[model samples]
Target chain A: MGLHFTNGYVRKKRLQIILLQMQHIIALTVLFHHSYQSKGEHLRMTNHSAPTLNELVSGVVDRLKSAGPLYYLLLLITLSLVIASAVIGLLAMFRGHEHYYNVTREIPWGILISTYVFFVVTSTGLCLVSSIGHVFGVQDFMPIAKRSVFLSIATILSGFFVIAFEIKIPWRMAIYNVISPNLTSNIWWMGTLYGVYLAFMFAEYLFLLMNKHNPAVICGFSGSVAGILAHSNLGAVFGLLMGRPYWQGPYMPIYFIASAMMTGCAVIIMFHILGYKINGEKMDGDMERALEVTTKVGIMLICVILFFTTWKLIAGAAGQPNGAYPVVMSEVAGHHAFSFWFWEILLGMVGPLVLFILSKGRNLKIMLIASISMIIGIFVMRFNLVYLGQSLPVYYDLGVNEFKEMLTYSPSIYEIIIAAGGFGMTAFFFLLGEKVFDGHKVEHH
Target chain B: MNKMDFNKLQNEGVENVPMQQRRDFLKMGLAITGIFAGGTLLSAASTFNKAQAADFAKKYPYSPHYSMVMRQDRCIDCERCMEACVATNHVPNVHGAYRTTILEKDTSDAIGSTKEFIPVLCNQCNLPQCTRVCPTKATYKDKTTGIVMMDIKKCIGCLTCQEGCPYNARYFNEEKKAVDKCNFCIDTRLARGEKDTACAHACPAGVRVFGDLSRQDSEVFKTVHQIEKAVWVLRPEAGTRPNVFYTKG
Candidate 1:
């Protein structure tokens, strides 16, 4: 009887151990599922909802049941596409086959390059804005400071995503940049500086979160200085190109900084308003102060932007030794005239500037409208900066047979889908943050 | 009662303190004030010294280095440079890309004398503004070659260089995520031990010439030295001190 009892007891113990191990495994799987689903599903769902401007501005989370399954399906499709793209890229590299999308001598830059710049610029702006509260002691900006830091980090990750997709040989770029850094190269400096800046920002934020014994004042100050330098360096990347007429200018650095400030402010304001709506929290004094400060900054930035535009046009109007005035005149009056005058100037600049001025930085309704307009306007500005700058010919007087035709660029569907995927990724990360971390914590009144 | 007696005795003894003690406290106060004032003066002087040491002129220029020297008399508005650039750079043949092209302006008759060709490129200059504003040091002048070469690998593609170059020489390559312009074909020619640039070599009429100004015996050096009368660089007002010289034929 004792022998039988011992056998039974051992069997029971073994069963218990197996059950415990199974539970632990299940728990880990659940964690993984949540992480993946948060980014994958939420992103797809948000895209599919075709969330209206109102929905976006209001921060409405769509009903999950209907959108959830579709999102999963979309996620699966996106994953497949990503895999296919990777495989194709690898095949091209290994087999030495020419990919159709490969930028040739005529069009050396394309959608991938443009997208990469967009993400990097946005990330730089985000980082700078986040640093303002901690570094500059901008008391009003404190409430959103942590959130801004998180967003900046997230944006930087997004930048990496676009760049990874853009480069034919990303590994080569990474290795070459470290080993064979050309000191005179603007691109090298930009990459190196931003890389360092990202590290610093991450460290600063981590220190803030960990409640480390380091002096907060010193950390903040150093981070701010680094952020400004990084952001300005990003602008210098374009400004340093004396060869590219459109990008060569002293005002570009100033313009870049101002615009970054504007965008950063807009993003914070929009996010704050959205967070408030989602959490059903009343707008507090700190939030109000943050909005007010951002509004004033945004308005001032607009004025600066106008000054830049006016001066650029006036200079271009003046005749050049090479009689280059026609190029400028055509830009102002020719085929690209619509984008320059309307999309860039009207929608991006004038529209937002007018809104901000009329709102007087007081009314939330007006501020909301102005913020949305500014964001859209900024996108237009980026597009113009990227596309218009490239639209001009480099050498005008080659032989008749050798005369190059006008350049053309239209983002392929794959490119557009990938861009959409980026947006999805952003939305997914944001929602996950809200869900897991309770990121929408209300500031004390 | 005994404690009260002692306290009263101590209180009575307070009058026995020295008057010099009061003067000592006052002297200490004055000494501190004097030290503070002296420190302030010292700090101010040091700040001024640092400011004097800073040479703002040598640091960076706020404007383009080379300005266009328009010789209106010689302009014939052939627009050859514009066409050639489009072909070479593969500039979108669309309306926007005209780095160097002709602009039509009627002298007397709106229809007849309406065009003039003006070749525009980076006016290599003494005080290139693009180099100064580059925060990342992405844009730099070659000490040996005197050519401003942009390394795309380092470029963050901010487009500030375009605004700084007065000649509108800088073009942002949307595809490359960097600025592109007439490097005088530095990557292809000068860097590869060639004598001249694609633009200079391609110009059939000898409208453009490329040579190192560093070599005193070079043709460019002798030409600038001999024909000092009519030779002018573009936009002398920009303070760029352009290397390219233009003469109305």
Candidate 2:
């Protein structure tokens, strides 16, 4: 009815008026900002300081000053652990994988694979979580984008370190995976996409470092897409196995992405708070608010994954389908029951959910305790996911003599050392990141 | 071989067969297989269920279409086939390095008292999960023979293929530093002009019958198509559509 009454001249005049109004609004905003800038008291009250170069340099120097004896001792220990893990990994590589590792023909994967999954899942989660702030322009998530991006790179690097030992000839893999590309292979896609994802992540991090907001946002978007693709492919690696019915469904790929986000939130809060403690600095107001929102997000995802786990258990145990039944039982009441119940269910899901609630997204101590517990619990969760799916014999229906029951695998000494070394790599790089990257401090867009 | 004999054989209840005769049949090395499949049994001459069995060779993508039919009831745990495979393939004599092995199953419910010995090897599936999961193309199906072969040099020993296989057929060969499974002795024997696999030749109970499925007249094809036997495969639900068939003669 409104359109029918208006003439072309009238519409044109109205459009011209809107354009003038938009310009007036922009001019008024600029004038307001300029007036605010002139008031030093107002600027100080708002805490939006564009520090001079001298002030910036002094601030960085101040941040680099020694914190305490305990901090130095922690750094020294983590670095030593990293060095020891690298040396052991190299020695095992030279000696041959089959000789040193407990991985056999039956149980071909071990703790190393699970630990790699744990680290990389956290990386993908961090990328996805940070993209909410940096790419999607969510104000509450802004403070974490820089720190999470740096930690994502560190965590993925740690993942690669552990996988280097698991993959017997990584150099050969580097050559063949490119020259002889298997388009249909899930592993090929996971590896290749992760490589692209890493490149994008590095570019995204570099852009963030240079304070190029637009370019950093674009890179973060690209990195998120790549991370989702790569992370889902990693899940497909387990899901696509026709023999492993426990993991042979959409549940794995879907569960992985959800779990990654959960892990991302956990690691982000844990490390950021820990980083603050290590530097003897407290979380400022904005950063504290960001963690509060992130904690709420963590609670939501914890519930999502808890739902996934419940369904996984229910479906796996119902019929005792060839490969799924025994695995579910093992996790529920069998040998892995303690780890599953105590670590995966109680500590990983319930404890964090409860603590996040009690903290109300503000209590640093409770949040810190919850985050640390969730990290350990989530590591065990990854281990169970990888191991339980394989613990059931492939030929369970065949009813063979040797495979009358479930198979068992315990991490060997070398595997344990390599896994510890992987953790050390994360710690070492994380400590260095805090110092070298100037505590990852910067203003959000 | 004729319709009259077939009719008479059907009229005689399967349970009427003398225990001594059955024992003698196994002893005389004619125990082709009890031909148990999906919990049903059939006699020797009628290896295939005529009404149900069809020419599945239409699905074969290779020229030679190499296949094996296991006469399951005939396997008596002699392990001669296992020895022959190791000797022929130069397979490492280790716990998990076998190219083939025998399995013992308790069939006490069905067979009254005797435990059944089953022979298992690489099915060389029409859609081999092992070949599909190998990131480096270290393990692959042959273009001409349909035999699942391996290029040990390309194997990175990730063991992903071993995990992908539903049958637990493939294993890491520590000697070769690669994943290895039954290739039907293609390189060691078949390429050198041998007509059959080492296990087929050494089977004292005629437990293994290996031949080309592409040739309708081949022993493997006839044994699979004779229509009287309920011929089937192990783990048919896996959807691998293996070239191997198992039946009791």
Candidate 3:
């Protein structure tokens, strides 16, 4: 009887291991698919010559059908996982289980939440950049302004998609926030301000599409002001968290704004370059000038970011009575040392800065490389800001505190898949925009 | 042309009537009836029975929704509340998930003394900022219960609400494109008419008290009256008029 029981347990364990291996394989496949298939140029090129809508749809279907039983098996697995996640999410909401969350008392916030902030901040930045040309009449940026508006909307929608998966009671959030308002809270103001900004932008874009000049101009200006306030308030959300030493400080809001601008410029440059290449169009003088201006702005922002980072580190190293400074310093220096020195500072900040400077603000090839570098750098900066902030141990003065060791987090395969899905959605939107809007071309009045 | 015609008309002559005669004629015979009718209506409605005031109180009471009033002095900063909140809410492991938490404040002393603990949670303010800035009306306060809630379906995942919150209370669900924060466990407990949150139930020190202030006889009301001087709220200057009250002694 004992031997039989042991054999059964072994069989179960083996099954579990097999399942884990399969999940890993599937995740890797998804990542590969996104990296190649979802890329803007690749997607367009592959589908460009496909004669008809029916042919394209049939081709996609045929490809899936021809992939044999293994492909079908993978499809089944993917569908099951999606269904299971939805059911589990529903159950969690209704049943209210404490064990459902990865968050603990020691680390209150986690990776998913931080990434949400990263996307939204970037989106808001994109909106602001687009507005500079459309509303403020910065003629230099005019060539890319309309496309920028489309990108801003797309990015913001993508940010919203991330948050939808993260929150538990989204319906409740929608209902209470408007029906019951608190005027004094920065969050309230930020939400309302952005809400207003979004409406204004939507109106402005609609007007642009309809060839109505006056309303677009009026709404664009109003939206820009509102966007600035909303973006600054977002920074205040972290800055006001005095308890979290890493987040607290007057510079966080400014840092967020500057970073937003940098990311916006990088995105616009990337899309424009890629779009032009795919269309087989030569780069005009106006487009080249636009690139130059954005690159200069990006380079200057990088310098400002470096200054803020340096001051922050220096302040932490020079410890005070709170012990928060030392704790933050050591976490950056000792535990997250590699991420801080290599990824965050070197690759993310200095590398991009030097690349842009060396490019001399001209040369398409060099500028493209610099822009890509800056984009990667900004992502790394976001990762470090979030992950490193939560790495330190939270200690209590009492005897033998339970949470003595540093908290650790590595993104789960499922989490990574979901993140990749966000990129997929972005590409999908961009493609749809390209197909429908004739690439957002504006006629000169 | 209009100015010239007006000058000719004005020059033709206008006579002023006696002020008292004009006033008397205007009054006519309705003065006594008007006074009597106004006095009767005023007498019929007591201060509490005033229609507009009662309607306002019913619609937008004194407290907002999904807010938790904390007593800082009573808090030991055990963080039981934060743990309970995450477990019950299934909040993703991300920043800004704590619906209710304890904040520890201490000076940087080599000897590690002078530590202070404060419990922080959603203030459930009369003027909730989270609700005001929601673009899709995803974040809102409940009409009946005063609980701030989120609608996931409508949320476009703009982090504007996250940025707007001064208390660092709001979080973005990166995967779903929605905003999240402490809802005071209203959906799980309070929606079903439970008395307190998981944190309040889990707290061993009896420092956290939960009650409806709308009911004058509730413990929250008594505490507010008894320890008026010791109570405080986080960033009261923010003008949120938070429902979450704290007491420090």
Candidate 4:
């Protein structure tokens, strides 16, 4: 009876081992099948004309079929806003700027300027962030390069769109910017260099599409150099203001670059994740690594910006410099207090920083929440920076009736519509990018 | 313990200088400091000028070298000067859009009883931030007259000049689609071989003294150069080195 029981136990053990081995073989077969299918798809792509018109149409149709009511609603809203902006901008263009914009001699720049700054800054940040991978050959950052570069172009174009309405004679600018360049003027340099940056970026993206590695690298490096110059010059527009004590310093340029990096990281993470969801694809291991690295970089830049903001507040508060003090005080304890505390300090900086750390760069949902909050916060940050600097009267110390306290500037409907159009342009282009670029899929390296 | 004279103080290593000598020293120190700063104040705007020597004199390098000195105490709120400026220069009638304006200071406590009117126009700073910042040389300092002038045709209406000006001197001209400021009536009157600006000529109270600083005999030169009556400029800390000087009657 004991010998019979031992033989039965041995037979059962052999059966369990056979089942385990079968499970391993099945897993290997599935892996091989996935690779073979992917290889087949790649060959198909390589043989065809790169994204031919037929492919584009089919790809777009596929996206349209996947798109829900929410997508249509977003598109409708975007189109309506853009149309409204166009009507108002044309009216102002034909008539006079005074008819549409509420900008006065006291406060020349309004919401449109802020919106333009926000978009371009984001674009510049994306370019820089992507350059870290493409130009400098950082492995972890490589996965995001194509999407980042594409988005950068979209955002900067949006910036140009908003600013076109703001500028009284944009046509004149196009002519004069080329024919009559002012080297000393930061605005001129910024405008010209931004043009150059756009050219390089366009070439880089085309090279990326064609898979021309060396040319893409060259264009990317040149684009980075141009972007840095243009971005710093943009900062210098405010910094070099000798009269505006609030904006008069080297701090603006430095803060702008750091803030750009922070913005770039937030935007890349947010959009890349969204891109994945829209495409109905899971984040693979490499993409996950890329996001983790981005989160790390975001953490570092957030600290840099935090340090910058702290110093800005302390310095602006200290001894109360004439033009700077009133605006600073308002931001701290007056009208801007709510925006400063809730948006800039909490959502823009602290919340994102903490959330990112907690996420361990793995929790997508948490990171998404942080990214969305940050995007909103950063928008307000730009508005605050532009408005606050100009909010206080240029002659605040004069104690005159015209400039007894701070100046007020609320965006008119026209201004708001035009600014919103910038967002519409960005969204439209982004959707188009997703469809046309096939989710900006990085080729296997 | 410290009543030593200059000679005695010099022998005593200047540590024991008398209080009277210290007062003289203060004056001397101020004069020396002024000499160094005066060059910068006077030469700041000339640096932007393509046609100019490095050694720009305290007096401007223009032919007429137009300058204005305001007798601050004599101004009244009659605004006849503004009216005349508008009539002569075709300044549009609008709110906060003036080539020149009057700023009233209620100094009832500081002075004995009443408010004072400050008639202000472009100082045409030696280092004109407006000109330097203008992407298109729409606003420029005149090489011939040292007057800050504008080419309205070239303006893109960026408003950078308005931002750059220390004084609230520039305003966007709606009709012209360009920034307009006090060019000392250069386009309207000064170009027509007028001796003084429209405002200067039209002042009922002789409050404005307009003249060429390059000529030593001019009233503006005398008033600005001599420090006897404590002549000053508004927001001197801005370091604009304004061509406009303000003095109390």
Top candidate on lDDT is: 2
Ranking by DockQ: 2, 4, 3, 1
- DockQ, structure candidate 3: 0.03
**What C-alpha lDDT do the candidate models reach, one value each?**
0.56, 0.82, 0.61, 0.81
State the lDDT of candidate 2 residue by residue for A1-445, as single tens digits. Answer: 6555368899888789888686555333222111122212223212354444333333334444545567667778988887887888888777766667887777888999999999999999999998999899898899998889988998998999999988877787888888887777888889888899999998898787667789999999999999999999999999988878988988888999999999999999999998888766788999999999999999999999999999999998887777788888889999999999999988998999999999999999999999999999999999999888889887777787778888889998989889988898899888876754656776543
lDDT of 3 by residue, A1-445 (tens): 5335357779788789888686555343222111112212334322224334333333333333434464345445544554454454455455542235454334434545566566666667777777777777898877776667777766666655555555555564566557655564455566678778778877776676555668878988887778778878877766654334566667777888888887887778777776565444577787778778877877887788888888777777775424246455655667767767777777776887787788776777777777777666676677667666555543322212333445676655544444444444555555544433445556455
Per-residue lDDT value at A336 in model 2: 94
DockQ, candidate 4, comes to 0.43
DockQ of each: 0.03, 0.51, 0.03, 0.43
RMSD after CA superposition, every candidate: 26.4, 14.1, 21.2, 16.5
Model 4 iRMS (Å) reads 1.3
**Which candidate would rank higher by TM-score, 1 or 4?**
4
Cα deviation at A358, candidate 3, in Å, is 2.2
TM-score per candidate, chains pooled: 0.56, 0.85, 0.57, 0.85
Candidate 3: count of backbone clashes, pairs at least 3 residues apart or interchain? 73
Between the candidate structures 2 and 4, which one is better when assessed by DockQ? 2
Error of model 2, residue A356, in angstroms: 0.5
Query: Which stretches in model 2 have alpha-carbon errors above 4 Å?
Result: A1-65, B1-57, B109-113
For every model in order, the TM-score on chain A comes to: 0.74, 0.86, 0.75, 0.88
TM-score of chain A of 1: 0.74
